[model samples]
Target: MCGILAVFGCSDNSQAKRARIVELSRRLRHRGPDWSGLHCHEDCYLAHQRLAIVDPASGDQPLYNQDKTVVVTVNGEIYNHKELRAQLKSHTFRTGSDCEVIAHLYEEHGENFVGMLDGMFSFVLLDTRDKSFIAARDAIGITPLYIGWGLDEMKALSDDCERFTYLLPGHIYSSKQGGLRRWYNPTWYSEQIPSTPYDPLVLRGAFEKAVIKRLMTDVPFGVLLSGGLDSSLVAAVASRHLADAEAACQWGSQLHTFCIGLKGSPDTKAAREVADYLGTRHHEFHFTIQEGIDALEEAPNKEEFHQETCQKIKALHLYDCLRANKSTSAWGVEARVPFLDKEFINIAMSIDPEWKMIRPDLGRIEKWILRNAFDDEKNPYLPKHILYRQKEQFSDGVGYSWIDGLKDHANKQVTDSMLMNASFVYPENTPTTKEAYYYRTIFEKFFPKNAARSTVPGGPSVACSTAKAVEWDASWSKNLDPSGRAALGVHAAAYEETGNTEAANLMNGSPQKRLEMLDENCNSCLIEDIVASASCGWHMFVALWEKLLTTKEGNWLHKQNEIVPYKFVFLFSKTFLKGNIKYL
Candidate 1:
């Protein structure tokens, strides 16, 4: 993954404009820490913060076509680049970058080539000959891209966040046409309900293919195992294929799985079981409630089980995809989500909606189709109980106390009167709870502009469902908790029940082996501060610096701050952290 920023139709091509663009692009340095590149054409600018994953040595950005007329800056992986490169045999090749195919493809096929490319990408291609430019995102919108108008860099890129909105997935913006057009038109996108009979083997094959394609990375990569069906299935498939796959031959066949939670949390325990079963090298990180609170500044539902699924898939770029990209990119780690792969989504969506529905009478649970596909008895992918385990959102799974701790901290910080008056303070998407109010205050402190706040989505949602899907159950409408427990009745264990009978037996068998904790001096805990500081960037560090320095934990964080790369500290310390933060 990389960071891309493009500005076109600017009237000014001055040194000041170029410097400003570089400065703003540096804000995303955390996303792509390896290198930076910039391409300029008169008043237009395209900037890239490169996180080298494919052909790291030679694949630098601002890639150009044979004649150097077509230039492009990209942020994503093109899994089919090798095939695409084969087709462009006549064109003289440049770097071995997977994204290098983009400039050449645009030169060969004009703007219609987006559909031909099979990958998760967001790129801006400049046709220097005519000064016509096109910006496009992958079909599923797995990569993040935003668009804005005018040359006023501040308003175009930052202040007027309302105008600078997300570029629609499966669509492209053309400077010549001066508008947006949908480039992705798959069969499932049509309104007709798919009637194809469910086929488990076909579904399994498609998902496996998706997982394999994403393994095309040069750097060390691991799976984020939440111990849920989605992540677990991904790990199982990747693990099965690793031994013979090309990446494994280089990175090794031992699959590494990672999980983070309070020591005895459900997710931690569940992940341990799966890792042991799969024989993966598992790394589990434990965080205290206090540390989680210190990092506060840094940081669903089905179909009707079909109709809602369609809407949810279309809207993923806004929520799930965005969060996944930002959270992982903060630490210079690129996350590949196979579930969002275009082909896999199409196959999954093509199935009849009826099969997807939660049918207690049929003994099918949520995502039962997926669970059953990997339920191979002869060559078991995972233990049966783990395969059918109940779903838990990260908040609940990452230790139930994690959420409660945040709520408790918020309650102490945000009084009842403050919650009561939240509507006036927030006004747009008014905070409905003290926790919401507390976070909103911190958000506004950093991003005070009205336009910035408007970018956030709000409204009544049940268990992370869309406001429209809240109609699934009447009880859901009563309590707007965005928790899996609120979904009720759907799971083998209902909202009232803490654990399923079959799953409970697995947990009871083992008092999970505890990983060693950090020593009394908290030397290792500095990694947490580095991650938090990296995730939030300099502005957030400045906001928290004074408060952090006043506490015992703050001293530890200060020690961490001292050791982080000089670039981060150099950028903000003298300007803001050295007692001038009041101006901010």
Candidate 2:
């Protein structure tokens, strides 16, 4: 990742404004420490800080087209630059940078070229001939971009200040239109359930391809294994690919995997197991609880902060893209997440959502389908326990004490008076706890403007559940903390005995019992009541079948099958078979 900043249509394109732009852009220098470039036109300014991941020696930013009439500054890797360059054969390129292809493409296709590029990026392209500009971000907002308005039209175009607002992901802002327009809209955004059949091999192939595509970098790269299913799967696929003779010839070594946590943390231990299994060169970094607090206290650059926040809100589909990027990029290492690969995501989402749901009583936990896919006895991808490990939030996995320590520190710093008057101090998102108040206080120090604060997400998040998820359980709305532990009753209750075993047993019985219960209680039954009853009844049906089969009723099965309609019996048989059998 790199840093990009630009201003267009400023009333005063004066030396002072240019200098101020340079100084403001300096705030993002950490994101790109290798090189810096600036492009100042008659009515606009664009600046870039280069991280040097691709074409390190020659791919500096503020790249230009053949005639230098179109200049562009980018803050992301263009994975398909070679293919794009192949399409733009007639255009002459100045630098070997993958990003340089963007300028030529813009020249060739104009504003429509943004969709042709495949990668994570936010860029500002200036049409120096007309003094007009167009700014756009990646389809998923993997690269951060912010736009701010100043006191007036001229000031708005001139100011490169912290007061800027986050540029919406998958959007384009043009000087000609003077507003934002949506440029990226996938069909899945409509919340349509896919009708594709669940094929494990197809799903696996898509994921493998995604991992392969992300391996386009010339520099050394690694996977961030948090010991979670998503990260573990990414590590697994990348390791398998890296083991390929061709890939090994290119990378020249085993894949490197990294994980960070407090010493002896759950993630540290789990990540070690995965790295060892993958035969990766694993690096485990430990930070003290105090050190974690200090890092948060020493707030990083503004661009970094904004990018992290935007990634969480917009890229919820991927879930861990920003975190994985931020963690690895901090050390100048490019991280790839196979799970977020576009092809992998499309295939995974196409599979019926029912396959992803957790059914603990049936020995099917969260991501059970994924675990079962790789649960090969002869060539297992991961240890059974590791494959089936319960999910843990990143903060909680990095030693529970880390979050507890932060809360303690926040409590000590933020007085009761401050929390009580939180609304008045910052009404946009009133702080509900001392921890939030303390953090907001520090955030306000660097970004005092309301727009900056608005960029940050607020409101109660229950166990990573979005606002819509609260509809699944009303009690979820009562929680304020985003930590997984806060969803105590919601998840824990799923395993608890509902204290109505009679009802449960009746529901769990054979088709006859289930029909009787539904007929008896259909008018007043709750979903939980029905689910509990059905689960118990199913187990009971299996036990009764075994008992009856051992008796003189060995022929009872055939008789029952004959009595029940073939189609109805087939549906019931499939349900019971899936619940009773252990596939992996």
Candidate 3:
């Protein structure tokens, strides 16, 4: 994935405005940390932060047609780019990027260029010769595009498309008068009486294809496993997808998967097993609850989490850590989340709630349909026992105590009197909880009195939903808390049943060896060496530890610490020498 930003129809000083595009694009570097490119014409500028995933040799983007007429900076992968290339009987190919097809297609099909492929993408193509531009987002919005326009006299877009525009998923806009028109309309959403019936077989087929399609990348890639069904299935599908791709490509890529959690967090253990079963080069990272607490005030490892769970813990975090400073091999490295893609969700949102509602049918997790939409061979990331597992909202996964901790922390910092008179603090959405008030306070730091504030939907919804879903469930009205902990039985029953304790067994032998490697780990020591040039001890330790523990050996270190006779004995002796060490 990459971050894309653009300023089109620039009647302003186009050359001087180049810096503005770069400045705006800087805000999105968290999304595409590999490299960046900006293409400026007489009237437009397109900027890209690339998370290169395919054809890395020539995949530096703002990838243009042979003559450099149509230029594009894209954010997602086109898995079927090879096919799309074959379909182009005439145009000369440039880079091996799944993104390059856009320039050629724009040259041939104009705005209609959007419908011919399968992939998750948000892109801006600027045509100097053609004197036109086109922008669009992926079908299900798996990728993100925020459209904005501001003329000083009139504002078309706020900061992050929060002002005047919305997420234009699966739609295209042209500078040629016919503004934004959607091209990829799934039969389910576009047809008057959509007959896209729920066939387990069809759904299964589509889901697998969606995952496989999204896996198109030329760089090292991995999964974001939350241990929930959505993340798990995504990880599973991704592991398999990478496996197949690697095998077919000879000596091309190694599918490395990554996951993050707090110390002893539930997701870490669950993710380990999924990684091993799929035979991926798995990496796991651990953070303390205190660290998560600290992250609340920092920009996420990447940006963009609706804070659907809480704060900072997000898709961008894993991506930033893994590829932030790295470039891709010939194959570009892309982080794929099948569950988040638009093509997949289009089917999901269309199905009736009864099909997805947890109960005897599937149990009441929201993405139930997403997990079951796969067959056995297609979905091995989770065992069937875990496959149909109900959702665990993020607030709960961080720890049952996480929400309570956040709320308690918020209460201490943001007094009840403040919430009692929240309307004064926020006339809109009127801060309901102490935690919200805290986030709102921070939000004000970056965005103070924004027109975009209106774009962020308010009013009541227990979890992530439109207000309508909350009205359907009476329990929501009675409870102010939106943590998934409310769905007690679901998480309880899954852990109680499949409770794959094997994942926690990392400490036995291999884990210690892994930790021992930390003593010599190249990635860690290098980071330490770099940090020594600046920063501080905590930064060095945190950075080194991030790389160290993401390895299996890292888990072993955590395990080794448990056996006091070994690592802890040394720790105890060291502490014993320090007079300040307290015996509890």
Candidate 4:
């Protein structure tokens, strides 16, 4: 990743204006510390901070076309730049930077060129001839771009307190229209459900192609292996590609895999197993519990998970690209992710969503299709146990002690009175717990502006479940922490009780009989009740109480007002009657 900042349509042309641009851009220097470049057209200013992943020698930004009419500063890798270059042969060559193609592509195709490129990027292009500019972000927001106006008034652009926004992913903004517009719409976003049948071969092939495309880098590159399914599959595919004759000649050695955790943590042990199996040179980095707590105090946690797979996919800019790039680029290394590859995403999304669910009776775990696709008996990709390991949130994987330490530190720092008055202190998204309060206090110190505060998401997010997923189980809405462990009991009970019964019956009964039993037992009972039973045994009490409250003589409500205990009436109506009626 690189840092990009540009100001267009500003009338100020003084050297002071140039210095101010550089000064503001410097705040993002940590993203790209290798080199810096600036371009000052008649009324536009563009600055770039280069990380030098692709062309180390001459890839400094503010790249231009043959006549210099078109200029661009980009922050990301273009995996298909070679293929794009082949299509635009008429354009004169410049440097070997994967981003240089953006300049020429804009000149030929204008803003429409964004759809032609396949990679993660956020870029700004200026057309000096027309004095028009366009800025765009990638499809899935793999890169970050903030769109804000000058706080100080600009004669050509805006007055004070102009509306500032984060550029929407898969969209573009233009000076000509002065508004944002979508550029990367796909059919899947439609309301109609997809009808494509699942084919394991097509699924596997697409993923392999995706992994292979990301291998197009000149510098040393590696995968971030968490030993979970997604990262493990990425490491497996990358390792196979690295051993190929053409890839071996290009990269010149075996792949290097990396994992970080506290000593004796599950992630550490699992990652070690995966590295040994893949036969790659792996590096395991450990941090003390205190060190992790300190880092959490400084950066806080911003991890997100897929509700369906229960797998953690770190949100793009804040966590993956910016954080991962900064850590690795310090050692002159670039990290590539096969899971985020464009082709891979489309293919994966095209398959029926039902196949992604965890069906424990069939020994199908979360990400079951992916695990089974790579489960080769003749030449296995990974050990059976490693392939079936449960998902763990990255922060928890570091060590449970790390989170416990944060809670302890927060409890000490925040008084009960402060927690009671949390809304008044920071009303926008008031902190509910002491830990949240501590992190928010630190966040406000660095970003005092309202726009900055609004960028961070608020409200409940258990195990990184999407807002819609709260409907999956009623109790999920009550969860305050987003840790994976919070959902462990629910997962274990659902699979263990029902799954074990079905497996046992399979030995003595027909497959059809097993299916019928599973539907009758699992579907009729609400999943929330199943989880509630596992967690508190509350479902048993509720069921027994409901049975006692009912009678064949009259409506349950007629007897509820007189004979039933008040607490029993309330519980019965709420749990059994759907809270529609209340007994006096």
lDDT winner: 1
Candidate numbers, best TM-score first, in rank order: 1, 4, 2, 3
Give a tens-digit lDDT track for model 2, residues 123-232. 88888888778888777665556676311111122234555665777788888888888887665444455456667777766766766667665454556566766677
On lDDT, the stronger of 1 and 3 is 1
Write the residue-wise lDDT of candidate 4 on 1-584 in tens digits. Answer: 66788887677889888887787666556456677899999878888877666676788888999999898989888888989999998998689999999999988887788989898788988899988889988876666676774211011121222445467667888888988898877654442334467677777887787777777654445566667666777777778877662436754557666566556666667888999999877766665444433333320011111223222222333333333333322222344545666676666655655665555677766667777777788877788887767665555554444444445556767889999999999999898987677667655544566766655556555554445554466667666654445544643312111222322343211121211111223311122222211111112222222232343312322333342121110000011110100000
Candidate with better lDDT, 3 vs 4: 4
Worst 10-residue lDDT window for candidate 4 reads 575-584
- lDDT tens digits, residue span 1-584, model 3: 56677776666755557767677775555445567887777767777766544665568867898898778888766767788888898989866777888888877877786878666677777778766777776665544455674111011133434455344456777778668777766544532332244556656656667666655543323454556555566556655565576433632344455555545556566667666766756666655434444433331110111221111112221121122111110012233544444555455445443454345443444444455565366535467756655445544543444455445555657876888998976887676877667656654544453664543445554543334444545666556664535533545633221122332332210111211101222332233212111111112223333355446644643553332111110000000000110000
lDDT of 2 at 32: 65
**What is the TM-score (0 to 1) of candidate 1?**
0.82
| lDDT scores of the candidates, listed in order | 0.66, 0.57, 0.50, 0.58
* lDDT of each residue in 1-584, candidate 1, tens digit only: 67788877777889987888888777667667788999898978888888887887889888999888898989888989999999999999889999899888888898889998888888888999998999898887767776774211122266423455667889998888989999998887764578888899999999899888888866656676767666778788889888877777666898877666665767778889988998987766655555555554340233345556666667666556655555455555567767777887788788887777667899987677888888899999888888988766666666555555555665667888988888877789897977667657655544566655655667776544677667656778777454545545644532122243322332222122222222344321122222212211122222233443355523432343232221111000111110110000
Q: Model 1, stretches more than 4 Å misplaced? A: 149-156, 159-162, 299-304, 487-584
Q: What's each prediction's TM-score?
A: 0.82, 0.75, 0.71, 0.77
Off by over 4 Å in 3: 9-16, 149-164, 190-198, 247-256, 279-281, 299-334, 340-382, 487-584
Q: What is the lDDT of residue 546 in candidate 4?
A: 26
Model 4 lDDT, residue 235, Cα:
76
